[model samples]
Target chain A: MIQFSNYDIISNLLFATQWTILLSLAAFIGGTSVALLLTAMRLTRNPAMQTVVRIYVELFQGTPLLMQMFLCFFGLSMLGYEISAWSAAILSLTCFTSAFLVEIWRGCIDTLPKGQWEACRCLGLSFLQTLRHIILPQAIRVATAPTVGFSVQVIKGTALASVIGFVELTKVGTMLNNATFEPFKVFTLVALIYFALCYPLSLYSKHLEKKFNVSR
Target chain B: MSLVNLHQVHKYYGDLHVLKGIDLDIKAGEVVSIIGKSGSGKSTLLRCINGLEEYQQGGITVDGNEVTTEDIQVRRLALSVGMIFQNFNLFPHMTVGENIMLAPTIVLKKSKAEAEEIARAMLLKVGLEEKFDSYPEKLSGGQQQRVAIARALAMSPKVLLCDEITSALDPELVGEVLKVLEQLAKEGMTLVLVTHEMNFARDVGSKVVFMHQGKVWEEGDSKTLLSDPQTDELKQFIGAVL
Candidate 1:
């Protein structure tokens, strides 16, 4: 049995935490970009495009994230398409995050009065200009707290990626537990790491929710 | 030229008819006030002129541009028509000046400095030059409506359509807004107002259009028609309102 020191264990866990953070940021950025495009599509007058986006949102949001991960990783391979665990995790996670995010943003946008859009239209603003100059600036302020709150979900969600053989914090913890024979210690540390990463965001979201609601 | 012409214009809200074959013409440099009870489609008529509401039938022309729901047509029509709402739809995200400048800077493609100069001039015109940096939320109902007027004026549209522009104000605030509209009317700005201020309509408005059930029930010189009340409906309306 190879012996592992406390420093070695802690350092390895910290390194794995780095991957967890990296995955979360990548997923968030990719998800937001995709969500923006989908949000635009959903708002368009083209019913077919709106329907397509609606179905896309429903398909991803209606399903389990774990199942999505499995399908992206193993299902694709089963069909003879080569894909890496990391790519699969990112891909499935982006879709999952975007599904929730698009709805969250839509709720924020809808909170504004219909008169805002009408006002923009009468000013001769094109739809895109209205969104860019007026609607989104206001909506983004309203969306901030909810968007931050949703990020914690993304960070916690990255743990499920471990089940797909991605060597993130949870996966490394499982491996460490097997070698160290200390579920109480290894998993406790893993859980604590996630708490450290997610707690501030949760607090910040609550703070912002109170701040924006009060100011507005 | 007739700055705005509506010939047998018809509008429908789903199966319910909103504007029933309305025909009216508004010439340049005239102040026309539209008045009626709720659901009479006075507001709908004002909205139709600005291309905000699409009619199921008939045609509307503003400064030689046809009013249509098509994006290009609406954009073209906007150059000729400006509208102020009862709720004072100033962009809350923008400063008083930015709210005034946004349309010109974007739609009219004015340079930022030029837009700001125009915005300042409009703010001065509305007597809110000191509030150029203030946000809409910080202002009172009267102040915000003034800012909205300034915003509309910044576009330099040939015709300004006001839809019950004072209905949302407090009774005290109503005077301030009416005072501004009265001033604009004196300046011969070709104002079209859907209003309830009978006194202001009579005193400042050149014409009063009484709308009933989505049709022009009676219309004529404001001072005479409002005082005389030609139709029984107008008499009833005046009696009910007064």
Candidate 2:
């Protein structure tokens, strides 16, 4: 049996925690910008524009995140390009996160009453003006809770970055377990850390959901 | 020149013909009320004047702008033709002030301060100066409808279209909103209204249009149209209402 010092295990895992947080932040920001763009295209009147956005959303949502990371990391390498694991992780996570974000935001925008559009039209405000000044302002309130809840999913999803050899929390836990040969102990710690990161966001989203009652 | 004109107009909703071979003209500062039963195409006639609906044949011209086209020019025509809906249709997310000021600021390029002043005056005119900061949902149905009227007036439109504006309000609340419209007519704002209020139609309007089955059944001075109907259709309509 291999015996390991708790102090060594704790130090290594704590040191790697920052990478997971950084990955989550990167994915969220990149994904949100892309999602907003996709939402605009999705709502546009042009058929060709709507089709392109639809295909982009479906392609990302239909594929597993694990397959996406492998394809980004190894598949791209076969095309004579060397991409770092961090780059591969971010690219795949962003694509995956944005697809869901676009759908959520589109639902928010769609929920606004038809009268709002007519009212703006009677005012002679252009389509973009209506969206910016009227529609989006109301949509922000409906969008807040679901979007914050999705961030928790995104934080947990950072774990899948480990398969591509990106050294986030899951990778750190695996490495520590290999040295200590304590699979149960290491995974428990990983689960606790994930809960620590995700629980506050989960609670916040629930509170907002209750306060807004936007489902109506 | 007429302030509003609809010539030989024909409109269809897929297989259902709504407006058929209609012709009408209104001069500036005229108050005309159209009375009809539900689905008699009263609302559709009002919508077409503001370019909110398209006619398959003939054309509508409001303030000299053609409204039958699908281009921005049609929207431009709508700028001069402000419409208030049956439901009030106030932007619920906006403050009463913002609802009134949006078009003037965006389409008319009025400065924020100027628009606010104009919006305040318009709201005050409707007896809603106290509710400027309140949202549409925060106000009563009558108050919201008044705010919608103020919103339409803030554009200083050449003509105003009211489509069943008082139909959604409580019976007690209807007078307050009509009082505001009465005040607008007194102020000589050119107005075209579709209404169910027969007493107000007889009293407030100089000219009254009676519509039935998507055609103008009878139209003339309000007193003559109501008191001495020239057609059985108008007699039947007034009989049913009375």
Candidate 3:
């Protein structure tokens, strides 16, 4: 076993947090793009398009994220493409994030009264105009709290990428623990770092929930 | 020729026939009030006129243009017919000024300054000129209903359809909204209303229609219809509400 100084372990974990942040951001931005498309499809009058989005959502949501990561990591290898751990992690996490986000935003859209649609329709606004000017502005208020809350899940979910050899915060923690044989010290620090990132988001979400409670 | 006409219009909600063979005509400057008990299809008839509720059979024509299921045609018809709902479905996120400006700017393609000017004028018309920047949730039910009226009028519709606009307001606040409508009727805006205020119907309606079992059970001049009992249903309805 190699002996590492306390400063060395601390510096290494902090450095690894950069990868965790980058992965989380990529997953969030990409997931939201795909989720918007899914939401639009879900709202369509076409039964076939709606069914396609529904199956896609259920496929990602019904299966475990860990299993999805494995398929992207290993399944692509079987197809003769050289996939990097970073790309696989991003792909799998994006799918997982989108499934949850589509459902979250769809619930937000449904919360709007049916009369809103009728009112806009009677005003001679087109469907896209109604969504842009009327429906989405109202839905964003209902969606915001839960969306920020869900982002905390995305940040923590990046830790699972370590299992597939991605060098994120958790992977760095494991490596340090293996080298120094200090599981308790290393994992407690990892948990603290995660708490540092997530707790503020949870608080902010609650703050927003109170601020946008316009129904009352 | 009638400005608004419905010929044997029939509407259904799956197996339930809400509007069965409704025939009506309103000329320019006519104030027609539709009155009935709950489930008597009075509101449904008003909705059908605006194409808010689709009829399964027959036709609705406004200004000689037949209302159809086509989006473009409905939109064109919407430019001529404005509707006010019971719940005052103002865009909650918008200020009263913005609510009035939206349709004019987006649908009519009016310039921002033009829309704002129209909004200000309409707000003044509704006696809520000071509420230009206030959100709908900040206003009382009566104030919101008046804002809804201003929003509808901002479109410059030839005909205005109001569905139980005062039923959702407090008894004291109902008169404030009706006062605005009465003012509009005096100005010669063609108005169709489904209402529960028996007094307003008797006093202000140029034509009062009594709906029962999905048909026009009785209709005549408001003063004549309310004073003379032509049917048992009309007498019972008037008795219960009056």
Candidate 4:
């Protein structure tokens, strides 16, 4: 049996935690970009475009996250594609995050009164102009808190990438427990690290919700 | 030629017809008020003229352009017709100044300085010049509605449609908004209003149209029509309202 000193385990887990942070960032930034495109397509009022986006959202949201990671990690390999575990983890998490975000943003846009749209129309502002100037500016208020809150989910979801042999914090914790025979210590440390990362985000989101509510 | 014209116009929401066959004309520089009971289609008819609602039959033209639901055409038609909604509909996120400047800079394609210049002028006209930096939510309802008028006027439209612009204000606040509209009417800006204020309509309006069940129930000068109704609907309406 391998003897992992306490210092060895802590250093190894902390090093692996960087990957968790990096993976979460990759998923969030990519997920946000794609969500924006899908939201624009859905709001275009074109039936075909709206239908395509609706299907994409439902497909990702309805399935389990683990199943999606498995498909991206293994299914892509079987198809003769050379995707790395990092790429597969990012791909699955981005699709998962974007699906939820599109709905969150659309809800923000929907809460605006129909009169604002009519007023835009009457002002001779083109659809794009209205969206840029009036609609999005207002939607940003309601969208901020929810979007920040959803980031917490993305951080936790990166732990699932360990199943595909991605070397993130959770994966390292498992490895350390096997070597040190310290599952309680390793896993508890893992949980605390995640809480440390996500708790500030949760608090910021609550702060923003109250700030916007006051202005509203 | 009339500045605004609607001929045999009809609109339907599902199976329920809202605006039945109707014909109307308003000459240049006319202040016309549309009034009736709730669901009389006064607001719907005004909305159709501004291309906010599509009519299934007949046509509406403003400043020699036919209004249609074609995206580009409606946008083009909107250039000439500015509308004030009942709820003010000001962009709540922006300052009063930014709200007025948005359309002109974007839709009118004016330079920021020019749009700002005109926006300031419109605010001055609405008597809210000091509110240039204030956000919409910070203003009173009447102030917000006046800012909405300034927002619409920044486009320098050929016609202004007021869709019950004062309906949402407190009873005490109604006068301030009405005063701005009165000033606009005095300036020979063509105004179309859907209103519940019979006294203001009769006093300022060159023409008063009473709509009932989606048709022009009565049309005439305000004095004769309000004092002596040609139709029983107008008489009963005046009785119930006044």
Candidate 1 residue lDDT tens string, A116-212: 9888888899999989998899999999999999999999999999999999999999999999998998888999999999999999999999999
lDDT of 2 by residue, A1-37 (tens): 6556887777777777889999999999999989989
**Listing every candidate in turn, what is its Cα RMSD in Å to the true structure after a full C-alpha superposition?**
1.4, 2.5, 1.9, 1.4
How well does candidate 2 score on lDDT at residue A83? 98
Real contacts recovered, all predictions: 0.72, 0.60, 0.70, 0.86
The window of 10 residues in a row where model 3 chain A has the poorest summed lDDT is A1-10
Q: Which of candidates 2 and 3 reaches a greater lDDT?
A: 3
Badly placed stretches (over 4 Å) of model 3 are A214-216
Error of 1 at A153 (Å): 0.7
lDDT string for model 3 (A24-90, tens) is 9999998998999998888766899999999999999999999999999999998988899999999
TM-score, candidate 1, is 0.97
On TM-score, who's better, 3 or 4? 4
TM-score of model 3's chain A: 0.97
Report backbone clashes per prediction.
0, 0, 0, 0
Number of the candidate with higher lDDT, 1 or 2: 1
Model 2 regions more than 4 Å off: A1-4, A214-216, B68-71
TM-score versus the correct structure, for each prediction: 0.97, 0.92, 0.95, 0.97
lDDT value, residue B131 of candidate 1: 99
> What is the descending DockQ order?
4, 1, 3, 2
User: By the DockQ metric, which is better: model 1 or model 3?
Assistant: 1
- Write model 2 residue lDDT over B121-205, tens digit each, in one string: 9999999999999988889999999999999999888888899899888999999999998898898888899998888888888
